[model samples]
Target: MLLSRLTGVSVLGLALLLGACSSTPEKEKVAEQPAAELYKESQIRMEDGNYRSAIAHLEALLSRYPFGPHADQAQLDLISAYYASADNPAALASIDRFIRLNPTHKDIDYALYMRGLVNEDEDRNYFQELFRIDRSDRDPHNIREAFGDYERLLREYPGSKYAPDAALRMTALKNRLARYEVQVAEYYYARDAFVASLGRGKYVLEYMPDTPEVERALELMALCYEELGMEKAQQDTLRVLKLNYPDNEMVLTVGS
Candidate 1:
């Protein structure tokens, strides 16, 4: 019985010594990893729409080897992840970081486009909320930032692979914003703010020629001028409307 206990103790001591000797180096086991592997895995997760898992690996890779060969790719994927996860602030930050670090990258146009995505077409829901809650309005800053990024992609990287997509999105966004302007003009018109209505209507006609509201905008301008009893302006707005829409019958007066 004593011999058996002695043998067991000897085996246990040897096993403990081996465990101590074979422990992985702290850095190698945890924080350090092959950059290419982590990046590839992150990309795979992103392509599969597993954005949260992708972000986990990307954040780890970036923390450890930020300047590695996959840094730029990881940074872009991080932005996508935040967007997918609906974390707008993080998405903005990631795109900003990518832009600042990779201004000269061949696909920098993509980064610019992404920044636009984070701020692009301002949804009416958010706008209405801001107007309701904030007397101090900072929402316009985000709109302008998004617009500027799209404009930058157009100007600096016109021939980029992403330029076509960016241009399409930019046009769509511009049209939506113009529609907002028309809404304001209609509001003023309804309130009998004749001068403001005329000015806003003219802007829609002159600046945004492609919107569906252009015809109605001219009609509003004519009404405003006639209400203010400006004969020449009334005639001119009617003339412009008839010229633009030759076949459509126009009502020149409120009751008619």
Candidate 2:
């Protein structure tokens, strides 16, 4: 009878031990569901092209499970949605936050790429805005700012998929910038403002060399020299202009 009682206690203890082990894993499994469900819902919303709804679902998931497995992916999706929806400022803000939060995330490369993407889009918009301006009210300062942003993206994200796009943008931006300098120089030249025109025109060569404007720059410099009574300087400038742009009508006009 005593042996039977001891056998019963051993069996009962074994059952209890198994139940405890099983319960812990079951609790963990339960804890994991909300995040999984959230991610699933976000994916569904994304597939439907309801980016805002996807973002909301992901945000809710993150709010409830900050350390969930979906956190990194959730961050990326949220920022991408903002970008797709034309919420650049918000996209940039979210990207910045994510970078600060997960500097070492495995998909850091993707984050970097997205950052470049947003900046490229920003540069496109800035130039569009700058170009759309009335010539009567075009601001040199705004053009300069747009150029600066383009340079920043090119410099910072050289390996981005958007690099080619940024390069194309830079080409257009530089041309506009070069043209702006030429226009300013011409304005000064028209008023017999040789000194100011020479300064502004010379600025273009420094900013963008070997362009169509280079001939104009040299021609203007020659004019500045003539106005200043620097005959040797005038002749020397004209010689270089002729050497480089022998076929330009202005060269003939100036020489004649």
Candidate 3:
């Protein structure tokens, strides 16, 4: 009986030892380097086009030292890294968060510029691009979104370093929008929807007068007026088209 009790005690002790070992939690692998070191490593990775690794390092550094001196810059770098990695949705979210969190940040202009670029990149059409199709008939929703982003950036930071490039992009966007309007006018005219075509053409002439598509819009308006028996309006539109595009084939044909 004594021997059996001793054996039972030994088995219980072994079980307790195994239980204690199992219950002991493993230590987390601590980061040995400082946040600054991690940030530098991320920068190097980004410069070398290792954006994924750069993002990982930046994320780790931010988590470890959320309030460090490099936190804000790290956040900015993270956005750039995400963009470079083509993680556009994450980049956009990060940019918006940064803007909201640091409204008066010195680099807000850059953030806005980057936001515009990201939105614009998302607006590209694959088939249209591959086929070299005219953009006039393409969906303008994303284009409009990008245009709004750039417009807000310009309005908020007129003197920003990125203002000039944003201005150029805005001009291109306007021309595209104007062309889309002209295309719609042409489509309506093709379908004998004279009033609708005239309205769309007039909208372009009034709001997008400076665009190259203005000539086409005017031509469309003239054609619609001619078809609708508005002789006076048709003559007036033809004169305006002749004044702007004196050698235009449509003007020569329609004017005669």
Candidate 4:
């Protein structure tokens, strides 16, 4: 009985081993494919929205033929695949590698744009989206990085096809950043930290002019000045606010 049981266990183990080996043959076949064939397969997979499979094929092609004619295009496609598959870190690393290696490549603008998109997306996750939580008051580090990426893309490639979209995104980022500053100032002011609140408000005015939040920043600064007993500064801030926004509620109330 013991011998029969051992034999049955050995048979099950052998079947498992065979199943593993069978799976590897397909991978080996993929690895042996020429660079062009792998690239074509990856393209097909990408077109089918199978980004995970596309990433595998693109990575294999790149690893096997780093100098092949398709290498550059494969690298760019790999970044897209990684991003589509929600592998943000991999996408960013691939984008940086492509930029560092191909600084003057014709598609450098696209890489920069993708970098900005990835960073911007990193600031929001599925939970935030599902809950419809406002992200403007969150930490702005990723938003700042994305803004810088878009700014660089526009500065370096003014004539790029991506320029218009980059410019629009930059404007939105500027507004969001200005709003973030205002929120921080509000937090400080609520705590009676008038000096810190004033500094934050000044940051929005000086560095983030023309944003919609500028009016709010000015109002907050004036209030902070009042709290700190800085009458002259409060008057100056209110004057500027009224000049820019004659119908502002604070201006009308203070005048009354």
The most accurate candidate by TM-score is 4
Winning candidate number (lDDT): 4
- Span of ten consecutive residues with least summed lDDT in model 1: 1-10
Query: What RMSD, rounded to one decimal, does every model reach?
Result: 17.1, 21.3, 18.0, 12.1
For model 2 the TM-score comes to 0.61
On residues 133-197, what C-alpha lDDT tens digit does candidate 1 reach at each position?
53222334556677678889999998888678777876766666566667777889999998998
Candidate 2 wrongly placed segments (more than 4 Å): 1-33, 58-67, 99-160, 190-193, 210-212
Better model by lDDT, 3 or 4? 4
The window of 10 residues in a row where model 2 has the poorest summed lDDT is 1-10
* Each model's lDDT: 0.73, 0.69, 0.83, 0.86
lDDT of model 1, residue 164: 85
Backbone clashes per model, in order? 0, 0, 0, 0
lDDT of 2 by residue, 1-256 (tens): 0101112335567677558657423111113348889899888978887776777787788878889888889988988777775566887788878988987776555565566556545544332343465342244454455455456656765775656765675676676667777888888998998899989877877878845677788878888889989998888878888888898676688765
lDDT of 4 by residue, 1-256 (tens): 0101112335567678558657533332356798879999999999998777888898889888999999999999998888886678998999999999999999999999999988887876554554568878999888999999999999999999989989999999999999999999999999999999999999998999989999999999999989888899899999999999999999999843
**Model 3 per-residue lDDT tens digits across residues 92-146:** 9999999999999999998888888887767764445545676668778767887
Question: Better model by lDDT, 1 or 2?
Answer: 1
After superposition, which runs of candidate 3 have C-alpha atoms over 4 Å from their true positions?
1-33, 126-131
- Cand. 4 TM to true fold: 0.87
